[model samples]
Target: MKAATFFDGIGWREGVVELVDGGARLRDEVPATGIPRLDGVVVGGFTDHHVHLQLVDHSQLACSRLGRVVDLGGDPDVVQRLAVHPVRIEFAGAFLAAPGGYPSDRAWAPDGSVREIADADAAAAAVTEMAEAGASCIKVTSNSVAGPVFTDELLRTVVELAADRGLLVVAHAEGAGESERVIRLGAARLAHAPFTERLDDDQIARQSASASWISTLAIHDDPARAVAIDNVRRFHTAGGTVLYGTDLGNGPMPVDLSPREIAALREAGLDDAALLRALSPVDPLDPDSNLLLLPGSSPAAADPLAARPLTPADLKV
Candidate 1:
């Protein structure tokens, strides 16, 4: 019987986890058998909801603390091949963009990373390509600040096509009006907290009612970071769902559960409880899944989300 404190991705409870035969079972009392006690806080598996597999040294992921990663943009073939990683991999294939749109010109974007679809017909073709390639969702780029963006006609086209294929559309909504456009066109997720402009209460309310925002808050410089954090705070206040995503592989960022990203989310007013929900994209209370055992008998009370992950061997011990 392993005695440990368990945070079920929401609330904390003192419980004993017994690995009876081959699985962990949570119980309130200690069992009468010999088993190594879990010496730390066991929480739900953490997920980095936004990443780019093409830009990172993915070889390190096999030993990484992350339990899951979602590749927001990458080479479809490369993402497919990397799905065998020990850490669960979910991905959205190639950036579907307007001709001469954002990321088509970015130096870090690898070849086969962008499919510049031009019209409704082209949008359907592009969406079909991604779905056929086994993408969990569709990624659309509407970065009017960087280059040409999708017109309302094209945005509607992509959203409609993606829906027909049973896929959700996640958009890189940037610039003055891009966020509003995509929110209006029904993008299911935002790749980043809208940073370029302060959203009106109505805009935030609309987004809160209709979609979720991924907090890539630490990726920005001071003024933008400040703006993004403010928006996140207000959006969450309005009952908007906030997803903890770092937009990993964007630059000098950690591939693991990023402390800096977690710090920024905390700064944005996500307390331990809200941050716990943000960290776990998948259900943590499942009977079969082994929960994440982080090192430490007790995590920092002031910064509980900063706990470091334990290796598999460490968990067994």
Candidate 2:
């Protein structure tokens, strides 16, 4: 319950956190539980901002250290079932795209997982359907690399519809000009840091000012990796919100916190605090009921990947 370093919302400090009624309370003194000493720092549970619940095993994810997840794309029915799982889930029902667009033909994307908007007039209805299905946000695909993308008019309609519904919009922006197009259309977030093209300073500044970009750095292994890293580095330096995400289930990756992804963010100039902020749960969701306990004196700052998420059951009174 005591930690030499504790993340007290603002920063890490020497303090003790007491477990109470499935929540954590910071206190100066607390009775020991007769348990062995835990020489690590404690912090709030981590959230992966982008994942696909339908593509990955929900049970495996719940057992991992991640205490929360934001599923960017999935089938409505399947994703809805996961909402009641142990780990907190904030999901976007499905990938809204043009007919025959990205993920529609992919083997991993199931039927009913990709809703195609053929007309701009249907944009509002599409968003409403997802909202009815319990989607916290709306996800769109603007990936020209795969197939036809939404026309500007349709994209604008989707964004406007989501805004009217009080929902944030996230887009999978790929191919040249896609990132800028998504930002210009007023989407609230990007599924991945723009990797298909290197964003110039102006573009970086504009994207940073307009939308948060999820860091899926570990998904790329070729030359695109450098471009993504540089873009994210500049985006973070420009004060943009960089969320931690691992496009999980897109490839072979760890179900839990990914050390490669964490290291990649670190390489992109996100110091400990910035990295933790990316991992921290977003608002509208209650603070994580669990706590993260590491095994060391907590470095100058916390290494997110090193911390172990602990539930109330894992803690001894």
For 1-317, candidate 1 gives per-residue lDDT tens digits of 56666776657766666555655656655434565667677765578899998788877766666777899999998898884354788899999988999999988999999999877888888889889989999999999888999888889888988999999999999889888889899899999999999999999999999999999998999899999999999999999999999988988877777878888898989976688778873343555343666565464442444455433454365
**Pairs in clash, predicted candidate 2:** none
C-alpha RMSD of candidate 1 = 3.2
lDDT of 2 by residue, 194-249 (tens): 99999999999998888999999999986999999999999999999999999998
lDDT value, candidate 2, whole model = 0.80
Cα shift from native, residue 42, model 1 (Å): 1.0
Model 1 misplaced regions, further than 4 Å: 10-16, 19-39, 281-290, 295-317
TM-score of 1: 0.88
Work out the TM-score per prediction. 0.88, 0.89
Worst 10 residues of 2 by lDDT: 281-290
- Looking at model 2, residue 143 earns an lDDT score of 91
